[model samples]
Target: MPREIQKAYKNQTRSVDGKPGKKYWQNSVDYKINVKVFPETRIVEGSEIVNFINNSPDELSEIVIRLYYDVFKKGNKRDSRVNPKDIGEGVELKTIIVDGVNYDLANSDKIKRYGTNLTIRLREPLKSGQDLKIEFEWQQKVTLTLDRTGAKDDTSFFVGYWYPQVSVYDDIFGWDRLDYTLDTEFYNNLSNFDVNITVPDNFLVWATGTLENGEKVLPNNIYKKFLKAKESKEVIEVVNEKDLEGLKLKHNTWNFTAKEVTDFAFAMSDHYLWHAASVNVAGKDVLINSAFPKGKAEKHKKLTSIQQKVMKHFSEDVPGIPYPYPVFSTFIGLRYSGSGMEFPMMANNGGSGVPVTVHELFHMYFPMYVRINERRFAWMDEGWADFMENLVIHKFFNEDKSNSFYSRFKLVTQGTLGTIGDLPTVTSSQYTGDSYGYQAYSLPSLTYALLYQYLGEEKFFKCFNSYVKRWAKKSPTPYDFFNTFENVSGEDLSFFWEPWYFEMGYPDVGIKSFEEGKLIVEKVGYKPIPISIDVVYKNSKKSYSKIIDLSVWKNDNRTYAIPVPNHDQVESIVLNSDFPDFNETDNFFPPLKDSYEEKGVKSSIVGNYYVEDYNIELSIAKENEALVIYSNSWVWLNTILIPKDSVNFNTSDKTGVLKYLEDVSGRDEIELEYPKYNLKLKGIKK
Candidate 1:
């Protein structure tokens, strides 16, 4: 265990048995905010009243506030490039009142400012189990950069990270002072919010929580339909283009209230189509909504229905947990057409199709409900969401293997593993740079899916549901997750965890030999992966796949033998599956040369070929009077191939030999042999 985790145990904030310690506490703040938005000017002005409860045992001499929009401020450090048009003065503070004491803004001794964090020294030390009140007024120009929160156009905006809020004071990390670098996301406390947003009279708002006064702000007929859709299972067009055009402008304030949520966000648009539906999850009706521009209505018409199915599947099938929120909305006007960002009860979507919708909705369970700390361990949430999204796509949506999640997972895993920028799952997400997507999403998701396969559906979900239930509404470290699964499953999964989570390696297994009713498979890579083999029979001309679970490698055995039924009738054995493999060229047995021995070389062998086992590229051709072979792998360069006969070939040196093979695609292939080096490499003509 790391020293930090050991310290957390000694501090009594977390237990070693995968549960919260007796003295575990998380600080929270209740916010009352009033904000006004000007669409034409793209300005947002807000004032907030914060009631912070110090639930931790340590006295707080100082407090930290996160200003997320400071990434747009000129000269601030940023992880990635931002739109130049959005660069401006970040948040302008107008007034600050702490416990009714006025503070001077220009006094350097009272406050210190970092790139995106503000540290304020308190006048008096706040004792344990005490509380304080703070008030602030600020204004910021809404950015057009189309980040997680930004304006899609002059009249459409998805606003997040707009308010200056108190940072999380947790049991493990005291103050989450991580900068908002547009790289890592956020870590926040579950707090209560009562916000009143004042927008143009014609614009409509879709926010993070249930609208407390929807009847007062919305049209009378539309308000009735919104209420009716909450109880009905049918999808209703609550605010269509016609309703948006016909509504009279009267009230401008939209009131919203959300209790025990991580953060708040809202989207406003003058013209957008809204669809609504409801589904009963654990005896609670969850209102599902989708809003998009009229131009995207045709593409997003079935979004609410899809969300209904996802809600039901996620609640009843996978995690077996109830939906936590009463209302959920997806606003479809993000900058790009395929990006999506998740909040507590809302999503800023890019109007992509079903997969993005399902992927973003799955986040509601991981980081949102379970409160996974995205600033450090993003894979904890992103990996699970991607895994569940792919699982639902295959099981519920009936997508084919080509379009299935596993296909993409295999492709990406194979491409990324052992590459230059590849890192383990335990690495901090903010440091992974170009490989962040692979580390946070593909690799871990593949690991989870493989774990599911190894544990089977019943045992897998039993442990999975336990982890979710234990960490719901709380922050959990990676050790907490690792320990919970081990505790629930009653198994020490160090063998599985060490290689995939903490180590650097990829999975590569290949066919060694098949003889005497037994097949020997070799583990060429460091990571342990399940073996999937397909056996083709010559007599029956049929094939069946034999699956070996990942537990076969529990002992770190390099080779395993499988008893093949009717081995005498087996014509070819191939190591093939949806799982990732680094080198697939040698997966086919019987050495393509043996099958084509009866027929003479049908195609020319003068071309380049790749030998994956040696990581070598071989250029072979008839150079002058000798068949010269040039290799750029390992230590050797060139070798001479002399014709032994019309149909056979051998090198000038007696130790080297070669034979012809016909590829499945009718390309000419060869098996090059070096007896002195004990090397037999299969090379396909490219």
Candidate 2:
């Protein structure tokens, strides 16, 4: 542990018992916001009241607010590269009020806005356990650029990062003062919201919370269909294109309320179709919703069905918790992010694949439920999601597809068969520079999977669910997560977490030598992973596979010898893990080589021959020069027939060794190993 972490533990921000400290605290906020969007003008106007409670022990000096729309602020710093044409005029602040007092409209030294974050120095210090009400009225233009959140076409808009939120203040970091470079993900204090959005009457608003007043806003027939669709076993068409006939009302307000959420986001469009259905997960009937352009809805009609199945899988099979939120929604905003972005109870998506739907829905479990700090540790969220993705595939698809996908992850990650520049999961996501997906998504997920294999499914699930339950709705750092796993599993996982999470190398273990009834193995890489090997006996010729625990690596054993029973004549030995071996050349150990050979014909060395310790290339010769040749290897010898002319086989004509072997006896197999350093391999006659 680092000095800061130990200090935190001593300070009671975290506990030595692998749980959040008794004195741990987090601030809470309540938002009452009303926003009006002018889609034609590509602008949004909002007025909001934030009721913030200071739950910490310290007195506050300044409050940092994240005005996400200011990312488009001219000359703002960005972690992700974007085209200049995509930038907009930035957010405009029209009015600012603190605790019912109106400050100077233009030049208040207390108010400072830099980049996307605004820091306001308080005139009256907010005491501990006090509530402060801050108000703001602002407008910002939507950009032409498409990202996780933004406007899509002339008809659709996926609005996110549109409001100002108070940065998280925790025991570790006083305030998360980091700017929005869009590299690291977001971490916000759990908040409650009562929001109202007003748009053109033709537009259909699909948002974060349950639609509380659908009867007042939606068309009468559409409202009836929505109610019917709530419990419908299949998808119900709420509002199709034909429902756009009447044009009496000009505008309407849609009200929504959400409790105990990390953040809130919504999408609205003037020309999208609406679909809804419900499913029973965790003894709760959660509504599943979808909205998309009429042109694409036919192709994506089963989205609601996938959502229902995924919800049930996550609730009962894995984490074993019922769905937490009341409503789950999936809205279409294609060409925006090419994937879905998950909020508290909704997902903004551009996917038609089953894996994508399941993967995004799994997000609702990790950072949303467990509330891991993603900006610093994205692997905590992305890793868990990728791990669950394969599980879902196995259950819904097939075991073969799941296995194939699992291998694909291994190959792309550090476990690849060749040297790859990889980083540890403990490294910050923003500082990963490149290879972000492999670091955040593949490597960390592989850790959990390997952990699953280390501890069987029963123990693994118990420990994992314990961590989720303990940290629900709370912020946990990387140390807290690792400690919880060790505390729950009753295993010292530093040996595992050290090499897999805190360091950057992959595991490379192979058999060194096999003799008598013993097999010696060598650890070629820095990583000493748990071993699995298959041993063969010459007498029985049957292979026996066994997995060894990782405790053997505790003594720093470079070469580990495993004693085999009934082992006078050991046939061969091979190594394997659940993942893969980057190199297979050293994977096998042998007593397996035989020193003798069978009689066979040998040519005058038609291919390249060895002479005077040098390789000599030769051209094709006559028919007699090409003779039948048989060659192979073993601990002593496998089998071969040596002929009379083969040994002293016209060494005068063959001046050099064979550089490349084409074929022998109509077979492309040539096996030979040099006893000392140099030896000649004879080529067969044509």
Candidate 3:
């Protein structure tokens, strides 16, 4: 552990048993903000008054504030490329006040501006258990390049990170001073918000928090539909195209209030469709809404329905926690074609699809509700979201468990091992660089899934729920998470946690040899993963499979031997595991090979031989002195099958072997030795 974390433990701010220390405390703020949007001018003016409470033991002279929109400022360092059109003077500060004393704008020593962070030298030191009030007035221009927060189109916008707020001061870190580089997400203090947004008449606002005065801003008929949708079991189209054709707003100010949330965002458009529905979660009606461009209403029609299913699945099934927020909304228009971003109670999604929707909404349980530090430990949030997405997809969409994206992620993970892309999870998002996506989304998620399978459903949720319950709405470091799981599971999981979270290595187990009545397996990788083996008998040609639990690696053993019933009769043995193995070619006992025989066939007899009964088509065409046999039914058959005297051919690989026979009476036959699927077809040449 680092010295800062050790100091944190000594100070009793964080405990060893995976719970907040007795003296744990964090600073927070209460914000009252008002903003006005000018769609025609692409400008947003904002003002805020914040009441900051100093809950930490030591806090003094200076306070840091984050200006998130400064990523668009000229000459600012950014991890993501921004459109040149979006570049401009960042957050123009018009006024700054501290505890009713206005600071001079021309004072050089009083304020320091660097990157996205603004340091305000306080006139008087703020001691422990004290509070101060501050005010700020600023304006920023919205950009056409739709990032997490920008204009999605000419009339549609999703606004986030648009406020001037104090940075987080926690026990682990004095003050989170990391710059908003547009690559990493964020870390924020949970606080209360009272926000009022003003837009032109006929423009509708869907935001983070509950709309405190919906009836005041919306038309009477539209407000009625919104109210009915909250209680109705069916989806209600509150703001359809027909409603927008003649829609007129009675008032322009939209009031909203949210408590104990990390951040807030809102989406507004003059011609967007709004669909909403309600679902029972933890005996409470949680409203789910979807907003999309009016032209793409048909594409996003099922968004609200999918959100309803995701909410219920998360609440009642795996992880098994009640929905944390009162409302869930998804805004489905981004500048990119395929992307999504998650906010407190809202999501800005690009494509109207199930996978992205499931992945984004599942984030509520991670960084949103659990309050993990996404800037430092993105894996804690993104990984779980990625892992749960496949589970939800498999459960609700009936996707095959073996064929789900989660199971297939091993392919992607293994390909990156020993390469620059295989960075450890403990590395910060900024330093991970090219490997950021894999480290944050694949490694941790796959490890968590393996741990889940190791500890059955009951024990896994017990530990999972405890972690969420303990850290909900509070920031937690990676150690806090590891300690919590270890404390709950009543076991030291250092062997499992170290290599996966901190070290740079991969998981691989291969068959060493089969001797006497025992088969020897070697641990070829650093990670401790479960083992799966399949054995075939020579006489009966029957196969027997066995799976060893992950606990077998608890002792850090290098090799293990398992007794087989008929070791001498073992014809072939194959080892397969879901864990991301760097090299799977060595898993076979005798080692699998990819060798094909050369069959020179005459290309003069060019004909199409297809099975009319099964609707399987095969076309043989001569191209560049080679015969290309294309089979429309199966992928393996679409290969270059060289012809010899226009008669017969054969090819074999580890996956399957193919054999073809041509008869003179216009009859042709094909045979494939596909495992568990033996296919033989006899067709006539046409």
Worst 10 residues of 1 by lDDT: 399-408
What overall lDDT, based on C-alpha atoms, would model 2 receive against the true structure?
0.71
Evaluated at residue 23, the lDDT of candidate 3 is: 91
lDDT of 2 at 678: 34
- What residue runs in model 3 are displaced by over 4 Å at the alpha carbon? 335-338, 402-406, 515-518, 534-546, 562-572, 594-686
Q: Write the per-residue lDDT of candidate 3 for residues 1-686, one digit (tens) a residue.
A: 99978998999999999899999898889999999999988788999999999999896788999998887888888887778888888888999999999988678688887889888899989999999898999999776765667897777889887889889988987988899888788888888999999999889999999999988888888999999999977999999989999778999999999999888899999999999999999999999999988878778888899899888888999668999999999998765545799998899988667778888888887898888888888988999898888667766776434432334345335546656567777888868876777778877778887877788768888998999999988878888989999999997888888887888877888778777878788898887877777677887957777767777878879888888888788866666534455555556554433111223443443567767666877676654344445564542353333222235542211223445566655565554343312346555566
Question: Which lDDT tens digits does candidate 1 get at residues 1-686?
Answer: 78878988999888877887777788888999999999999999999999999998889998898888887888999887778977887888888788998778778788788899988789998898899898999999788875567888779899999898999988777788889888877788889999999998889899988889988888888898999999989999988878877566459999999999999999998888888989998888999989999767788888999889888888888666778889889999776666799998898888646777888888888798888889999999999998988788777876344332344466446646676666888999878887788778888899998888888889999999988888889999999998888989998999999999998888888788887988889999888888877677886857767678989899989999988888888877666445676655455566444433433434366789887776777887654333556674431334444443434665432345787665547776778886533469888777
TM-score of each: 0.86, 0.80, 0.85
Question: How do these models rank on lDDT, best leading?
Answer: 1, 3, 2
Displacement of residue 239 (Cα, Å) in model 2 is 2.8
Q: Rank by TM-score, highest first.
A: 1, 3, 2
- Per-residue lDDT of model 2, residues 1-686, tens digit only: 77867878888978875798988888999999999999988788999999989998889987888887677667888777675765765678787788998756455588888877888888887888998898989888666665677787886888888887888887787888877776678889989999999998878888877889998888778888989888786778887767755532233899999988889888988778888888887666788898888777777788888888888878888657787888888887756334777788878888656777887888888789888788878899999998888767766655334123334344334223233437777888767755567667877887787787777788888888888887889988888888888899998888888877777666777777777667788887776666776666776857676767656776677888888766775555556524444444455453112111222333333333222222322233322222322212111111111222334321111111222234555543232333211344433333
Residue 375 of model 1 has an lDDT of 91
Q: State residue 611's C-alpha deviation in candidate 3, in Å.
A: 30
